[model samples]
Target: MASTVLIFSASLIALFLFSLTGVNANAGSNVFSMQSYGARGDGLHDDTKALRDAWAAACSSAKPAVLLIPKGKKYLNRHTILSGPCKSNIVLMSNLMASPKRSDWSKETIRHWILISGVTSLTITGGGTIDGNGKIWWQNSCKTNSNLPCTEAPMALTLHACKNLKVEDLKVVNSQQIQISVEDCTDVKMSPVSITAPETSPNTDDIHITRSRDVQVMDCTIKTGDDCMSIQDRTENLHVNNMVCGPRHGISIGSLGDHNSEAHVSNVTVDNGRLYGTTNGARIKTWQGGKGSAKNIVFQNMKSAVEVSDVLFKNIRGTSASEEAIMLHCSSSVPCHGITLEYVKLTVKGGSNDVRSTCQNAEWKKSGSVSPQPCSFKN
Candidate 1:
């Protein structure tokens, strides 16, 4: 019978040449490959429905999409939300491996394991590795246990209200809390990001910016257990360049007018920093009855202890192992204003070079070398 019509016409021309080599879609070359939307990337299954079906086919593709999580594999997202303004421009690259100990976390699905919200134009680059297995959530911290339930330990990656954001490089490790939380975002730009944890790993803060603005935090290399970078309370126009803070708690701007509230941080700048074995070198901390105003603050190289003020501490040197090496703790009624101390050198460890500095109602002025000396903020 004509050889059964030439074997069903050669199996319909080999299934039409395998759909022309499959999945390029060919409109603007949309590619939604999370292992072809099934992802058994072998970091232990449950690849979050193959990363939520490749983020809904590259977010409802109108083209210019590429949602690939390829490269040695490790996709195990929990509280996922890669929602975006996607009809164009998206290239979420990954090797994301943070599974919150493979499920069973309460309190709203463990807070925020990965929430990339309301995006406009996003670019999350990858060398790959985002694991926040954080030693079983810091052994289920109550942060000291006041009858339990203190820290639910979340935040592995959060960019809420996302605008034009870009997170590059990526080697974020061990974060059970505060690994990267950029809230209410705007033109955000992070560079060569690399954050690690465990200097004790309690409140693991390696970068936590709040109520964001035209921000830029570059060349980041943090070693954490708390505040390698924690700029809080209605931030605006911040820029901190080339940082490498240490064993932890080196960089901080305001435990911010806490409970009393009403805080507003502005026009901040920290240039070329490198603090090691830190405890406090350059600092300003407020909270006596906060209202608003931490103006044009600046830190040239290294240090901090925290508060909010009009700071300009140039060429700041470091070395503080506690007991006042330099702690300009201000705020009786918002007193720290335009406090500029140039070429200040700090030194105090294992006590007694007689190194001292402790002021209240702090207000300052000292040019070139305010070494081991800076007391009177005079009540």
Candidate 2:
């Protein structure tokens, strides 16, 4: 019988070639387009050549690409460098604005409107608005640098050495210095990001994660003047959760120094945070002839209202610290070890102490009502 009609026509031609290879892999995975390549949502000038020609057609392909600035208000005069070896995934939706420039202040150079370098697996989510107009970089860094160094410019989303980064639901505004600087990055995940400036904005630190590691900053809302989160150099496996810092300088770790640069901030954890009118709530700073060492840090279930020092650990010598909460002056060749504060609940209306250590195997114990001056255990 013609071999049963040639085995039913070869099983209907192999089921129509497996349904055309699943619709050609969903049509190359639905690569969304804003006029095929070149986007613009006119709101009033400077679209930076249609957003650098839609990020060069979304890094010219390797899959994921959705540069849809669809909602309105798009303006930017200078600085938008996203140099990368990106593998795809860049989505910036909702009222996008990267505006700045009045000749960008005589071009002295420090402009990083949206610079992301050496990326790998990048993702910048929606609810957008990145306006670092910064009053012309804070009136040109207070007229000619005023003896330069630390807080004279540069920063608005500068992520260098990135790898597997993810920044969610953005709303960063008026940044001059340190709005979001994730340097030496690795597997970073910043969630629900909402940072705002101008509480006397100068060196506006909202999120400065340096020498990074497997970091995770969650449920964020940072209002700043400085140090909403400043974990500087040589960091490791850090985690911060349910955060909401204010008027600035609340969560910090180290001003650590002196060549060797050791900062094994092991399994650090800051949870259920909410620090308002902050000037210090949780800190572990090191300086005063510098050397290095900060290990196994933890601050849990935090809540500080009207702070001026719910907790501050400092060490001075230039960088504006004459007196202000927990100042530790370590010298005798570098010493500060194993800092731990558990179940902390602080409230300081007028500055002073909650906990201050001079570092020699420091350990601060807490369960509540800590009134400072007690931690000097070095046996």
Candidate 3:
């Protein structure tokens, strides 16, 4: 009896050890070991097949699929499309290298190296770099010399129609267009994202969220050419917090247009942000004849350096053309309401008005002032 008891205890211990080993194997850094399916780690080899196979294997198991790029350099000559009805989380973790340029912008065609579309419950978290290798593309735009229709093209990371998405701890630099774009997505969270683009790079808005709902963007540093963050067309339940924006227009809502699709943006809050050298600190710009509404929006605890206005509303119809910062150029059909500003401090180095709003039923009540404004300005 004593020998049998001892034997049972030993068997249990062995079983536990085996289970631990299996877990470690499955959780092993999911590192991309090769450029192809069978090859070893040679930077020159194309490891796309290896990455796909690893993801397939992890997906088959009920575990998170981590497509680790490791520490070195991996090149992608073509677009990586992440289309999903995936059961497990897909992660692209790596210090990826941009594809080599063939020629000038004429032959430059690397669109969306990391494209995540039609996915759900995906989290892209890593401390790595995604370089767009955008020098040649920027040169092409400069050569064309046209400004109206900005020549910059598709973005580096495009998340379209994805839900429950989380993108964090990534450094994106030198992208041809927007570094990260979230469109028609819901329940998304983007945090600790650092993006850098040349101040003169046209149409390089760091993050543009459109037609999305229940989104949160926090703890980000965005330096770009266009609006650092632009929310347009049917974005609701949005929250932006603890951000730094520079070398571009500050946070903006709309350029909402006429005859285009219309959506409501409500319950949006932006708080605890710093803006430097931006065209406008906080702005709401709508076109002359759009059929949409912006409401329940609040800006709190925002500081701007060298901003055009602390708060601006350009409602062309209600206020004088030059008097409005929150412009409501919308046709009589569309209405704008419930826009609020609270606890905002701004320093406008250039000479411009401090506050402007022109929505028909808009309300502005805050305890802040511009340097040269009169003491009795209120709305």
Leading candidate by lDDT: 1
Taking the candidates one at a time, how many backbone clashes does each contain?
6, 1, 14
lDDT by residue for model 2 (304-354), tens? 432122343333212213233343333222233434333333223344333
lDDT per residue for candidate 1 within 1-379, as digits (tens), equals 0010010010000000011122233567676668887887687766877877787788787776767777776776666767776677776776766675735456776778788888777777756678877787787687744466776678888889888888877778887888998998999898878888888878888888888899898998888787788888888998989877776566777666767778888998978776655665334466766667778888884433333456777897767887578777764533465577788887767544667777776677777667765665322
lDDT of candidates 1 onward, in order: 0.71, 0.61, 0.61
Candidate 3: tens digits of C-alpha lDDT, residues 34-152: 34345333445555456556555544445565655555554453355657767666555555544545232232444565577787777666676777666656766753466633354
lDDT of 3: 0.61
TM-score of each: 0.29, 0.29, 0.66
RMSD of each: 24.6, 25.0, 20.0
Candidate 2, residue 331: CA error in Å? Answer: 28
Name the lDDT value of residue 9 in candidate 1.
Answer: 10
